[model samples]
Target: MTGLAGIVAAETRLSMVDGENGRLIYQGYLAKDLALNYSFEEVAYLLLYGKLPSKTELHGFQCKLAENRHLPAYLIRILNELPEDMEVMSVLRTAISSLGRSEFGWKPNIDQAIRLIAITPVIVAYRYRQQHNLPIIKPSDNLNHTANYLYMLTGEVPKDVHIRALTVYMILTMEHGMNASTFAARVVTSTHSDLASAIVGAIGAMKGPLHGGAPTEVIQLLDEIGSLENAELYIRGKLERGELLMGFGHRVYKTTDPRAEALRSITSELIGEDAWLDLAYHVEKTAIQLLDEFKPGRRLYTNVEFYAAAVLKAVEMPAELFTPTFTVSRTVGWTAHVIEQADNNKIFRPQSEYVGEIPS
Candidate 1:
């Protein structure tokens, strides 16, 4: 028998990633179903509590998220000092890693979750503004997490479609169990590292091409193709050279990524009549056709990356901010997973098959 990589954990109820079939289920519900009906707050509660929250519970959750929107003064000062040209993710990585030093002897459970949640958007927005020489914009307590992030990123109140598109992105990107970043979180937690350390480690992992950063590349692919007329040729040429298409493949989904469908719809609706929508549609169709003709043996289908890039672009978000925006939406899931892991009290230690030279 061949040694197993254990890339697919068959037993854990942690997360379900069905790449061949293109399905992603968190807890028990389908990601597409959640994205269509639930707000970001509702999905966050569902992920954390194992079921959808009732109306009253959801209201309370929204309030809690809104209440925690402000960043601490110290973090603000640190944000101000960061170099203007630094990448947003780099700034976030450093700021979050340093947050551990500020933890006082003790704080209440809710307080800690609140602290993590509140400061996330601030950190994201602060770095973005600093990069452009714009002043930091505080999140409005009256808005939900998704809404407030848009408000902070772009000073105007986003329309309903914009909010919905972003909310769907959040629901889709949230916890995928034992993914590279989640495993990083669990690994750091296993070492008894602080929450901030675990999160910083996770952020670093997510910054990689094979992980959370793929959407930015997907957008770049679209830009290079430039128009629908060029998409098929461009993608086919790349596929011929054995280049990995950024948005089409997944490690776990054997069929189709459900989140892709949800995001595709949101992008279409958000753009309505924009030229990019037609371009994206043509690209999607062309990619499918080319893949069918060229890579018949492989199950490469569009994943969350495709529509995530489209929707972000539709909202006029710069390509550089894509992953940081991902972090803004996913912080809820990260915090929820961290809390869940802390509750279960397991040190995520796994045995490794030794392949290196063994000492006598």
Candidate 2:
């Protein structure tokens, strides 16, 4: 199949993407359910360990994560040595690969998974700071993952609204059925590669604009629109020009993405009665109307990136950090799938169709 669309590569017990019905399920629970009830650490535990953690289990898990949050001095030195213009994803990939603390024979273990999830935010924040010539703030052992991410991003304690909005976004994005990056992670892991190598490859795949990089573009789209009054005209003009609206469509979901719905609600709650939220909603309404009018019968509803832009903006996250933050949240999902793949080892060797003229 072209782009391997609709091909079931592997059976997973982790998460399901019901594209037709617009639902995302993680371990038999609706994604929204988990987002509302679970903390990022708790969600990480569920995905990595296959069940929600008990109170004590959760405490221990949190401590373990906290313990692993700090990067080694050598890695920090390497972060300091990165070129000022180096992309965040490249920095993250290099740092994660540098985190290969063991030999290639290392199996997929919870310790490896926890270490990956824990260090991702630190790497992102540290690299971002160094790129901008800001001092690297150490990770906090006291705050939870979401809070700590924001805290490190800005060297101050995060506001509750920022914490909650980002937490929900993290939960919703934690896992879904084999997206490009997750597939990349699983594919690397299938070869019995070390967890860090698999994760590094996944980070590389996620840096692509077609995959994890769209959220930042969504922000650029809105900033270009500038005002609600310009939204309809700007959108209609783009549609008439056959331009791709950055956040309007999805490859899998025919209906409104549940993650987008969750993010819209979360943004509303976090930035109540704000100009940004008002503009985003106006843009959404206008764009949906224009799309329905311009492209008939092809229902292009709002996907996660649409409101993910708003939510990240609401939390004052820089545009460049959009995909890296995604990498941070998705590390759990990647490692979980990696562990699962390792448990049931199978080398992913798909045959490609020879398109060009082959020598007979």
Best by TM-score, which number? 2
The whole-model lDDT of each prediction reads 0.74, 0.87
* Candidate 1 C-alpha lDDT tens digits along 4-34: 3465422344357676566778778888888
State every prediction's TM-score relative to the real structure.
0.86, 0.91
Backbone clashes for every candidate come to 15, 0
Best of the candidates, lDDT = 2
Deviation in Å, model 1, residue 142 alpha carbon: 2.3
Error of 1 at 70 (Å): 0.8
- Per-residue CA lDDT of model 2 for 1-360, tens digit only, reads 488987899999999989899999998888887887788888889898889999999999999999999888899888878788899899898888887866434698888888888989999998888878788899999999999999998999988877888899999988987889999999999887899989988998899988886477888899999997899889999999999998987888888898988777766564444578778878998998889999989889898988888888877898888889888999999999998899998899999887788789
lDDT of 1 at 299: 75
Q: How close is candidate 2 to the true structure, as a TM-score?
A: 0.91
